[model samples]
Target: MQSLKEGLLNRAFSHIYVEKRAMEYELTKEILKRFKESKVIEIEHYKDIFSRANQDFYLQKKSPKLILAVKQNNLIYKGADVCEDFGNKHFYYTSIMMNCIYDCEYCYLQGMYTSANIVIFVNLDDYFKEINRLLSMHPLYLCISYDTDLLALEGLTNYVKKFIEFAKENSDLTIEIRTKSANFNLIKHIQPQDNIILAWTLSPEGVIQKYEHRTPNLKRRIKSIKEALDRGFRVRLCFDPILYIKNWRDEYRDLIEEVFSNIDADKIYDVSIGLFRVSKDYLKRMRKQRPDSIVLNFPYDTVEGVCSYDKELSRNMIGYVYGLIARYVEKEKIYI
Candidate 1:
C-alpha cells in the first residue's frame, strides 16, 4: 500500500487532470482533498491527454498522472475469448479504471494501452445502473476488476466497498474481484457476501520478486487471505498465468505447499490455474516495448492469434501443478 506522503502513487503524480464534467462528483472532491499538493488541471475530456500520440509509456510509468473522467458509453462488455469464464455463460467484465498500479513484466496492459497513466471513471452510479439493467435480463457473472486492481486502489477510490454494497443488494449478480494486492483490511469490516469472490493471484516468491513488481510479498498476501477466511469471506486462490521463470517447477511446487500449509484447502472457495497467454498483437507490442525483458522475449508458439508456451510445456506445467493442488483440494473444485 502507498504511504500518506506518496498520496496516489509510489511514483506520485505531480498533476491530476479532472474532466470539466467530473469535477462535481463526490469521488472527485474526496480524492482532490487528499492530494492538495498536486496541481488539479481541469480538462474538457480525459482523452485530450490520455489518448494522445507519441507518449512515452516507460517514462510515464515512473510518474504517471491520474485522470478523472465520466465514462460515456459501453458501460459493460462481453468477456473476451482470451479470458477464462470459469463455467459462467454470462461472463462479462467492466473497467472503472484504465491501468494498474503494479507493473508485472508479462502484463497484457503494456501492449493493450498506449499510455501508462491511470484513469478513473467517476460516474460509478452509472455502472451500477447498467448492472441493475443487465440483472433484470438474467443472472450475471461480472469481473469488476478486470483492467485494474480495485482493491489496491481502494484507499483512494472506495470502489470495492461500494461494489460489496452493490453485490449485497443484488444476489443474482456474481462478481469476481481479482488482484495481487494484500490490502484486504480496507473492506474487512464489511459482511462477506457469497456472490463476491475475492481472488488473489499467487506467484512463487522468486517469481513475485523477479517480475511482479511493486506488489505484496507472498507472506503478506497469505496473511490477508487467512484473515479474509477468518472473517467469513469466501476466498479464491489464483495460480493463473503461471510464468516460466527459472527453476519454475521447484518454485511453484514450494508455492503450492506453502499455500496449503497455512490455508485450509476446504476453507478456500476454489483454485484457478492457467499458463501465460497473450494476444499476438499484444505480444508484438510488448516485445517492442520491453526488448530486454526475459519474460517477453520467450519464443512462444502461436495458436490462432494467441501466443504462449508450446502445448507440451503448457500441459506439463498445468498437469504438474494440478497434481500438487489436487493433493489438498478436490479436482472438481479446481478450474483449469
Candidate 2:
C-alpha cells in the first residue's frame, strides 16, 4: 500500500504506496488542496478527462506537480484519422491520462515531461462526448492509451473500468488500452467488452529485466493477460520496440512461443509489431537523467526528431516479428 504525501510542487515526489484500507478522507482532501491550482482541462460525470491545453507546459524538466483534471460533461472526442493510420493515414493515439507509473529506461515520458507527479483527470463524461462525435463519422480505431497506462493506475483510479463499460455500451468504435502493468484485481469487477482490446507490450525477459523499471516481470504479465482472457476479454499482443540486443532473435522467438502457448490465439484480437524508437530530443533528455542507461547509448539514426534503428533494420525487425506471430493468429487479425 502506498501513502499519498504532500510536498512542494517543485520537488520530485518519492513514490507513495497507500494501503487500500488506509485510504482516509483527510488524505484525499489534503491532496486535493495541495494540487488545487494545477488546472482543470475539462470535467465530465460519466467519462474521464478529455484533453488539456496545458499538458505540454510542464514537459520542460522534471519537477513534481500534482495534476488533477476532472472530466465533467464532454468526454469523448472525434478522433482525427491521422492518429491510427500508419504509412498512409498516420499512427493515431489518444491519451486520457497524462503520464505513467513505471519508468522504463527507454520510455518517452522522461524526455516528454519534467515532473514525476501524476495528473488524475477526475471527470469521464466529457471525454465520451468527444468520442461520440468521432464515431459518428467513420468506423474508427481509437488508441485509448497513447501517453499513460490507465490500467496500471487502475488501483488508484477506476477510470479504465468505467471506460471499459463505456466501450461495451458503444460497440461501433474500436478502443485499444495498451499497458505494461500486471494489475489483475481490477478486471474481476467487470464483464469483458468485445470492442475494447487490451494490448500488452511483450518484451524479452532479458530486455524487461535490464531496461524496464518497477514493471511486472514477463511471467506475471502473461498470467494477468491470461486471467483477462479466461474471463473472455479481447486480448491483443504487441511486440513493440524490439531492442538490438545480443541473440535478439533467439530471445524473441522463445518469447513468442511462450506467449502463444500460454494464451489462446483464437481469442486474440490482434498483434502489433514495431521497433525501438524515440524522439532525438527526448533521448537527449533521458541520457542526461540516466547517463549510464544502455537504451540511450544505442546507435540510432535521426528521422525528423525521432531516433530509431536504421530503416532497413527497423523494417526487417518488424517483418520478422510479424511473421513469427502470424503463425498463431490470422493475418487480418495482425496489425503492424
Model number with the top lDDT: 1
Worst 10 residues of 2 by lDDT: 42-51
In model 2, what is the error at residue 285, expressed in angstroms?
A: 2.0
Over 224-278, each residue of candidate 1 has an lDDT whose tens digit, in order, gives: 9999999999898999889888898999999999999999889999999989999
Give the top-scoring candidate (TM-score).
Answer: 1
TM-score of 1: 0.96
Q: Which stretches of candidate 2 lie over 4 Å from their true place?
A: 1-65, 70-92
- Number of clashing residue pairs in every model? 0, 42
Which stretches of model 1 miss by more than 4 angstroms?
1-11
Q: lDDT per model, in order?
A: 0.92, 0.68
Cα RMSDs, all models: 3.6, 7.5
lDDT of 1: 0.92
